[model samples]
Target: MAKITGETRLENVLVYMANMGRELIVADRCTVWLIDEAKQEVYTTVAHGVREIRIPAGTGLVGHAIASGEPIIIEDAYLDPRHNPDNDRKTGYVSKSIITIPFRNNDGTVIGAYQAINKMTETAKFTSKDMELLSLAASYAGKSLESVMLHQEIVDTQREIIATMGEIGEMRSKETGNHVKRVAEYSYVLALALGLSPKEAELLRTVSPMHDIGKVGIPDAVLNKPGKLTDEEYEIIKSHTRIGRQLLKGSRRELLRAASIVAEQHHEKWDGGGYPNGLKGEEIHVYGRITAVADVFDALSAERVYKAAWPLERIERLFREERGKHFDPAVVDAFFAKLPQLLDIRERLTDKG
Candidate 1:
């Protein structure tokens, strides 16, 4: 007996059934057709022996079996009015008998129809035992396809959530652009250049966008102010680091934890002159260091309410000048080396607004 196992491919299942226990199994051709509810049509997926055939629901024995969700056994193809002989003519193989069974999902919904044609040797017809075996095989195929679809749905939902959170952070900054995407891409490139593993690079790509999430705590007036910030206003703005840390503290998720570190230390300078705790050098989290370079690069090149956009030349100059003073020297070096590719990404992803 042929067994249907978890994670088995549909083609393998079909081949297994063709070879299992039946003496003249090699003489038959197998075909699978999936029903399209919206189109009211049946499409062929796999066809052997039979060239190809498609019929509407209730048009032929195959269609009738699918519509009625039952097994069909045709012993004399030429005598059956519902038999479509075009397929046999196309494949140059006469059909003596065919057994088709409706494949049902776990919810009892008919997912497709499976058919085995032209039983070999004696005039033996398809039996109840054959239908029962094929039905079991179809069930396993349905479950495997369902599992794959469910997994895709989960991945799509995660992507939507991440995109929504990034939008929220971008809206809080009063920066009318794709600042989040640009910074995230920049951080990813920088992480790769710094020799981090691929997984770490991807983590930084996603978490870097949340570095300014604490800006949500700042007042709208200060956050969207058009003029230069005063010392007092600047001090309040600087507190966003701690505010971000506080907001994200105690989370067990590694992404959120990394976001918290980035929020707190992205503004900290290489020389220890930057805000909140004034921690410097290797004291800063690597995520924070990478985000700092990315954030500053984007901010400099992007036009904001308070600052005009800097030319690429000037941006490169500032990075080189501030290597050890404002930015990590290693990160800065990597940024310059990969500047061309970064510029291409920035241009490709630039927001029209």
Candidate 2:
């Protein structure tokens, strides 16, 4: 119960509750079905040993429990008219005994159902006692699911806002939204190739799009200038990193903090020749180093207001030439290792005229 309620991710919460439901009911398998009220669908992802499934809100025994707000215990599932044997046919798992209990939020609204199949005991039947225990578990799971769903919604909204803000920054400098999308995907692939965990890699993907967010503060004249800039104008351009950092650094949220670091240090060179702070390799945050490679690659490959796009061969040659001088050697190696995925991203999100 502690672990189930503590989980902030909806998927994790569903898996934990499903495992708990199987144990509580002493069944061979359990599935936690969630109601997508807006879509009028009931879906289950952690269906124990079977493939995930989704159906209309009132389609099967589980859906009937949800709609009728009743707990059902059937000794022979095949004999029950409401039973949907299609899943059993698909998986080749015969179902004998079953228990489906509706779960509710604090308001007592039926949110979903818990279905436990094939009791493990000698009778091959779920008793009244089993239904009682499962009902108790379902009640707790309902509240937890509600909280986790809310958390997921908030996180998704935050990601959308960040991406939109990043796009605004890019658009100010005449770059397309696809530039940030490509960079985000490229950063994710590079992070994984460099041996970062999936969670860390996903974080990089979400925040790397903001690497040029500081450009939002740069004057349009200098930002869009086709001609080479004077030293003073160049200095002003360089300050975008600091400006971006300043805009995001104060946030207490981890997402924004990660974005702050990427915004400030994406231009920093491996040899300390780059950027607002000139922090060198290893000293620079990995997020910054990773974004630096992604940002530069996209900038060079895509057509921009000031310059034409470079050919793939020329861009590859520059990466090889720069090596440790311009980018962390490890990140650059990872970049090359995942070049195919990066190219696919470019193709998919390639700026549409």
Q: Tens digits of per-residue lDDT for model 1 on 260-294?
A: 89889999999999978898999988888889999
The per-candidate count of clashes, in order, stands at: 0, 0
lDDT of each: 0.77, 0.90
Query: Candidate 1 has what TM-score?
Result: 0.62
- The local lDDT score (0 to 100) that residue 57 gets in candidate 2 is 86
Clashing pairs in 2: none
lDDT for model 2, please: 0.90
List the lowest-lDDT window of 10 residues for candidate 1.
Answer: 18-27
Off by over 4 Å in 2: 89-92
